[model samples]
Target: MPPTEAADTIVALSSGRPPAGIGVIRCSGPQAFAAAQALAGSLPEPRLASLRHIRRPGSDMLLDEALVIAFPGPRTATGEDLVEFHCHGGRATVDAVLAALVEQPGCRIAQPGEFTRRALVNGRIDLTEAEGLADLLAAETEVQRRSAMARAGGAFRRRLDEWRERLLALSAQAEVAIDYADEEDGETAPDLRPAIAHLRQEIALLLTAPRVEPLRDGVRVVVAGPTNAGKSSLINRIVGYDKAIVTPIAGTTRDVIEIPVSIGGIPFLLVDTAGLRATGDEVEAIGIRRAKEQIEQADILVWLGSPCEKPAGAIQVASKSDLAQPAERGGLRLSSVSGEGVQELIAEVRQRAAALMPKGDELTLDRRQFRLLGDAEAALTRAASLSDALLVAEELRTARVAIDAISGRAGVEDLLDSLFGKFCLGK
Candidate 1:
């Protein structure tokens, strides 16, 4: 989609294609009601679904029986007059409805994310809330859904508003002090140093909190070990599928095979890598190099080995335990064949992953918001050190601008395009 204002009525399959019981076609713009009336014979009352016989305009040929709902301007999702057609879940039926709407004078197909973009532009939601909505749509696990729900529910935005309000108040206080420093017997400015320090401390705490990005992108757990150590078998058991090929032959698995698995409601990327060992084959050598690289990037490394060969500093797992007793006393011992201690291993991994998750209340800011917050924190930190009210006020203004950027109060036109571009069509 191009970067532009929504000048025409837009239509899209808000509910995805057929095989289900129903499909919804959404239209929003100044002419939304006119377009719906053109096809449905007459517009339904606002916010109420009315059964209608949808037909082609002029020819008056019946398209399908549908439930049509109309919403007048400023109260709808996009803050524009909107219409929805709930029709039979069939490709031909949906296409015919869309075709009829587009044939009208002012209606056309909506671009990807155009609907939500309209919502943002119309003051229905902010950028942070929009991001949360995107996350909610993409969430696949319980934890992801909970986090995204918190964000979309405006919890995170309310917190940011509090912080922004504080900074704005402080900035205003500093400006007032500067304005009256020369006045005779003027009221003395409140000491802002303590307030600046408190704000800095709060921002620092938020910055230091555990990040939730791993929840959005699953936590990576890499299996590293020498050849034929049951790494593939162990991962297969954990994921409950043969995601990786298990063979007794050395160097059988070459390349990184990643499977997503959820343990204890935490999502994880279970990576089965090529065994780490010196290999004569060129392809096997490349795979071994990639395995080492995976180890470096992994959040948790499960070093699968025999009783005597565990590596240092990894979560040691004694593989093929049915064939040999555990060499180490504290490490998790498991036999993939017998399924012994596999659950224990999973529990351990979950504990570690949970440790890495951010607090439930902390918002997962995107890269732009993170950078902006960091800048605000830095500005506040600088303001805390200065005794001069003018310099401190300048720094406070900088911090205020940074905070405002997060909520789209200033300088974010290009960012809006980038953010809305990520959204799929019909949302």
Candidate 2:
């Protein structure tokens, strides 16, 4: 019996790709129980796993013996009835079980991020937490993982909750101030200045915190310098691999090659560009142009040329120090041939990278969250500056709306599809 479309039961293989030792097949929604029962015969005790013979419906052939568990909801992951079939981790075995469940009324395959999205829709989690979960899944470094975990664990949600409460109280106080403006000689007017100031200060602090994008996208470290200054050699040494082709020829590297590597737990994109010079060759000239663009946008620049001519804050490296030392011993002294000063150079890079990174699992805002916080802070600033009760209350309301958006309490319909699309189908 197929269940109605309005009450569809969703099923998916929740674990890693099959052909492993075990695969977890999950089902949720109104038809979860019926779908699981159709395959496993009967449900296990709530939250308890029990062995059951999963078989094809209306057929005598047995499929696989699996451990089955059920979670009745408003208390489960999705806040709905959910069930899990721990089947043998074989592609065919898992597929057979999924087919059996889909045959049940109202059961169908889950879409990408459908499970987590349902959790969000059902009030199990807020937007910050959902974003955190997505971050955790896509994390490529330890810092990224820890930061994502903090977000997924509701750190931002709790912080937003606090901000929202303060904003609401301030809003109510502004309203009261307006209502009782004539009654008392400003005695009844709750002074919102202190609270508003404090809240604004906090928001400002968060705005200054390290952002999540740099951690995810990696620090852009561009290696640039004059012809034959060992630019490629320095980058290859830094990354400890021959990512950039090393040759004595000045124009050997005729393009920008970016190698993403993690150094001392920090993500860095080591970029090797064509040696800078007046080149007449069209291809090399184009590469030089692209290199200049990369240099302009680089977070860190390893310059292997004259220190006086390097970009602002660029780390000048006196490359090929194995030979007689260059007169200009500026920036970090490095010799790729003798492997000297490489560790110190890397340490310097890490020191610079640390300033741009979030410290040890601490929460850092994404671009969207940062922008919203800025709006809330701006509104609160206006509220604090205004003496007119009517204007003050209006500003407070604006602040409230901005704060509400931090955790997705207000309009965020456009963000839902983009955010959920980042997740894998099982998530």
Candidate 3:
């Protein structure tokens, strides 16, 4: 049934690209039930899947036989009437069904993230949950999935709601105090310093936590050593494939080669760099310069050079250990060909990388989220120290605005387009 005539009904293939086992076509809005009824002739009971024949309007041309489910308005995923068609996964089948649905009046193909954008607009899920859904869709590694799951479960939104409630209470107190400043000595504003101080301390601790970037993009582990130190071979061994060209000759790898791999559920990028040496070739010099830059940016440095020359905190490796007798060294001695100590070195890198990620189910924040929290924390800090009720109220408002921006409750109109753009069609 149509909820309203103003809103456009949207339909999209919510499942993966066709040619799979099944395709899920989702429709939501006021006209969703009408469109579904037009094709199926009769609609199924809400939330119950019923097999139906999908056909063109005013014709007996069968589009596809599909299982259909209807969801009535206001409690659905988009907070509107919704329908889904579980149809055969062939491309032609999906295209034909979609054409039939869109041909109905007020029906149109959904834009990327439109369904989810509707979910956000209609108050079904907040921005933090939306962001979590985005991350879940794009997640390629185990840890990333875990982090996104926690976020999509509304952990951040729940916490922010608590904070927003307290802010409103404090704001009301400040208003009352201002309205009766001279007239009522008996109606003193409750001391908000205690709550303000406590809130600020909690937010400060979160500000110290790891950023979400390293988890999204794998942690960088750059391999650096002088020429012919077996840097290329070592990386190929760790990555389980030939990511870099290997040769006995020095200077063969005159550039940086990066390979991304997941170890023990954590993502890592193994970077093979040009051998460091004094080279007259302009190209080799440029490669060396880039290698140095990569080293500076590395989260973990694997040094295959002499132990004494290794940079601070580098994972020192005595390369080509198969050809040379084992040396008495505290660090690792590895042979890429023999596979000795390769797993240990990899374990070490993974251990180091784990510390940089969001710890088991910790709600991590992105760049924008971290910045907004920083703003809110600062406002709370200012509010805690102020004795004037009016000034404290002003600071609390600032904090609330910052917090609201995160949940898409206020001041987030500009963010919707860009944020939803990241989502795939039908999300």
Candidate 4:
């Protein structure tokens, strides 16, 4: 069912700018089909395209020839009567069509993500799916696309549904125990302790889902080591481009050079820093300081040095291995010149970065969403540890509310404002 006609009708250019061959002007609400019919001179069949000459409503002035399509209530993108006018992709033509839409009764400009927000508010999509739609818009890699697809496809909902069902069952069992304990015949039911324990374990497992934020956002890998260890060369090798200067001279890298690269389906911001060494030259000392700072800030620290002693901490990599094979202390050996261990280094980098990240089920591109999940998880943990059944039930209910906030099932205020605030208009 549509929202109780509380919101006004909204209209916007859905296809966006630089109108290729066509631009789509979309409208939805109680007045959607009527608005379309008023401007387009009768409705196109629902969900089917038809040619129509769009003109100013009540005026014979031709605006543009367009393919008009109508989607009636409950079958449309917003779960309302939605109509789209595919006009010529010119800025003027699109603007003229939008002008026509606003002239209709009860129509106004669509807010940022208003269309998807409608889908959310109308129960057409949950919060995660709504986030997925936005994530899809900004996805830049295959891994990102897959992560967004999972969220869009109700992975969060599936997880929550399982948790909610378990909680509900436990609550029901607890209630039955309380309700029927006084009965003379004494009704027996499943034990509450095991059920609660099982629920806690499942929740914990979900809380530990593979973290995909780096993939969803981007991963940062820093290349650092003593001078002449081929840090810049290793960077170029990993990026498959000579992005950084490589020289035989020590302290060649005196400043941090960061470049964004994609590797093994993951995005990487590769940082090539000045060699780390106890330097006498002021400039070289500064570079060493900066290198240590970059390493500390990096998502994955790649410590490159001579093929001699392995670093006590950090992921040690023996760069310039073509000269001499280094002792392996569960270390990665690589030769930027020969590409030795480059593949292994890349895999290890991604694996280590992923290990430090939160799980995929917990991977929320939206920072606010992740925080909410964390808050809810904390509440759930506290709730699960309570000995009192009623308190546990209350805490579980609170946890469910937080989960719904992420799912957008809680009808949060300013949600559209917060979401669309970040988007460009007419998107």
Candidate 5:
């Protein structure tokens, strides 16, 4: 049975590929059961699988023998009656099944993330959880999976809630002080000066966390050094594959070769660049320029020669330990070919990336979040700069509005669309 209040039933291929052992077609919304019936000829028991022949509409054409499971409304994903058909995996079979369902009135294709969006709209999950679900689906490493799981489990939401509560408390205190301005003992009644200062400092501290970047992404590491330092070989060893061309030719790599690899469950963009050197050739010059650009932009630089040149404000790593004697300058020495100090390098990378943002920190994950947090941070900082309580209150309100933008508390429809609309269909 479908819930009368449910939305229009939508269907999509739940499992991506076909021609496998099984294929899954998911339908959600009010008419989910009806759509399933049009294809399966009968509704399967709720949450239980039953074998049936899925046929095309107005014809005896058998799509495939499949197992059907029906979930009644308010208990399934999207809080609507959802149906699943496990058919023999094949593109033709799945498409035929979907076509039969969509041919029915009130049945339509589910848009990308429509199912998850329904869950969010129906109060089954929050925005943070929705983001986590997406992350979980896209996670490629154990660390990424764990982080996404933590986020999906509402750890991030709890942190956001705590930050919001602190701000709310401080705002309430400021409001009281503003309202009681005429009281003889107004200064002592609400005592917002200390509270506001505390809240501002706490927010400022949280804004320093580095997890903001790697929380949903990976770090970028560029292997840069003078020629013949085994840059390509090191990259191959790190990734455990012969991805980059390795040879004895000097300046062989004339362009940036970037590979997305994970170490110790930490994702990193490993870039092998043209040997950094004085070059006059146009192509080599461009590669050198790009190498420097990557070096400047990378989270860490793996310097691959003796007497490595250090980049200011970046971690320096000395590679090719097998050839060079144990001479320490200011960077860690490593030999990717010999697997020496590789474990330590991986650990250092994880630790440094983690150190970017401290735990319990709440900052923006992308440029949008950064801008919003920056606005709020700036507002609060400006407010703190002013000693006047009234001005402080106004500034606090402005900052609060900025923070609200990040949490969708201020009704940011455009932001929601931009964030959630990128998800795949049937998410």
Candidate 6:
């Protein structure tokens, strides 16, 4: 859809699909109350739920018995008049209620994310908060939930506002210097280097923040090494099930088998890849290539080998420890069958994963926000080197615009569709 005002009333099944105890249908727009009153006899006081018999418009047919609530706007979620119908979650009943709602003159089915889009357009939330809401809805791990919640709760907004305020102040000072350069006293421009340098330092810290994307998308940990090294056995033990097939054959496993495991509440994709070695078999060669790719992309690589074999720079694990006693190596030694030292191995993995996570209370930005921040940082860096007051002020303004884009104050028209397009219907 194009960037335009949302003037029509939209109705959608806010609650997920049928066969539950209750379903929520939300309506937002100018005619929200009228639409709800048409199907369900009369609405209770605003924000109060009233039990009523919902029916087909202009007919005696009873659709369902439901609880209806009205929220007069400028105070509701969408900042518009809204109503909700809490009805039985049976598929037919929910469908019937929606059918009756759409029959109203100004009511129509809501598009994907229309409710949240309306919320954004109506100034109920900013771009960063909206993105955080999206992340919260899709979060799969404890750390992901905490990060998303913090962003959605306006932590990032608060930090961005501080930076923008400082930049605005500096820009104003530069403009004043240019305005007074010709004064009788011959006043010179104030030194802005200190403030500019401080702001740059802040941006630099954010740029180097611990990786947050991996926390959202589960970290990949690939088990790699030569064939018959108990790689599959280790994966199965870690996942606590038979996820990958293990056999006596040298090259039985010929593909990457991935299973998600959470250690210390952090999500990880434990991948068992085909053993790495030179092979003439066409299928085995393909598997080996895929294994190499997985290793390159993995956040952590576990090199599985015998006690006598070792590889540099990988978290070495002595697999099949029951067959040969491991020497005093720096890496871990565990037997998948006997479960020796498995907990220790998991603890080590957890420590490494935690090291990669961003510290709590730190401002985290998604890809779009990070890119804009980068632009602002570059502008500020350029501004620091300029001698002319006018040029410095112009660069500061450029930097300010970039910061504004993160919170939807400017330059967000083109991004609306793609950003909200990922949300499920009815928000």
Highest TM-score: which candidate? 2
Tens-digit lDDT track for model 2 on 1-427? 1211337788999999989899998899999998888888899899999999999889978999999999999899988899998999999999999998899988899887888888887888999999999999998667778989988999778888898888788888888888888676657677789888999999888888778876888888888988789988988887777888988788999999989998877788888998889989999999999989989978788898887788898988888888997476777778998998899888888899889888858888887888889998998888889888889888888877887787887898778778887788778
Write down the TM-score of every candidate.
0.72, 0.76, 0.74, 0.69, 0.64, 0.72
Clashing pairs in 5: 19-89, 19-90, 112-425, 209-357, 210-356, 210-357
What is the descending lDDT order? 3, 2, 6, 1, 4, 5
For candidate 1, the 10 contiguous residues with the lowest summed lDDT are: 324-333
Q: Give the runs in model 4 whose Cα sits over 4 Å from its true position.
A: 1-6, 165-190, 222-258, 263-265, 271-299, 302-313, 316-347, 350-385, 411-418, 423-427
Lowest summed lDDT over 10 consecutive residues: which window, candidate 6? 305-314
- Local error of candidate 3 at residue 204 (angstroms): 3.1
The Cα error of candidate 2 at residue 125, in Å, is: 1.6
102 Cα displacement, candidate 6 (Å) = 1.4
Higher-scoring candidate on TM-score, 1 or 3: 3
lDDT of 5 by residue, 1-427 (tens): 1222245778888787777767788988888888788888897778999998988868998889999999997876788888999888788888888888888878888877778877766767667677767777877656566666765776545665676777777767676666666575635644565666666676676566445345455577788887777789878888888988888888889999989886665567888999988877889899989998988767777776445366665555677677766656556677877888777776776787666532432323544555666777787777766655677778877877877666556666665576567777667
Which of the two, 5 or 6, has more TM-score?
Answer: 6
Candidate 2 — which residues are off by over 4 angstroms? 1-6, 140-144, 180-188, 222-257, 271-298, 301-346, 411-414
Which residue pairs show backbone clashes in model 2?
Answer: 2-105, 3-105, 3-106
Q: How much lDDT does each candidate structure score?
A: 0.84, 0.86, 0.88, 0.74, 0.73, 0.84
Candidate 1 structure quality by residue, lDDT tens digits, 163-266: 88898899899988887675737678789999999998887776765555668877889998999988999998988888899888999899999898767777
**Candidate 3 whole-model C-alpha lDDT, 0 to 1:** 0.88
CA RMSD of all predictions: 5.6, 5.1, 5.9, 6.5, 6.8, 5.4
lDDT value, residue 406 of candidate 4:
72
- For 1-427, candidate 3 gives per-residue lDDT tens digits of 2222337999999999989899999999999999999999999999999999999999999989999999998899988999999999999999999999999998999888888888888888999999999989988767788988887889889988898998998899888777777577676667889989998888888788676777887888999989998999888887777889998887999888888887887778888999999999899999999999989888899998888889998999877777855656546878999998898898898888878888748888877889999999999999999988889999999999999999889987668888788889988
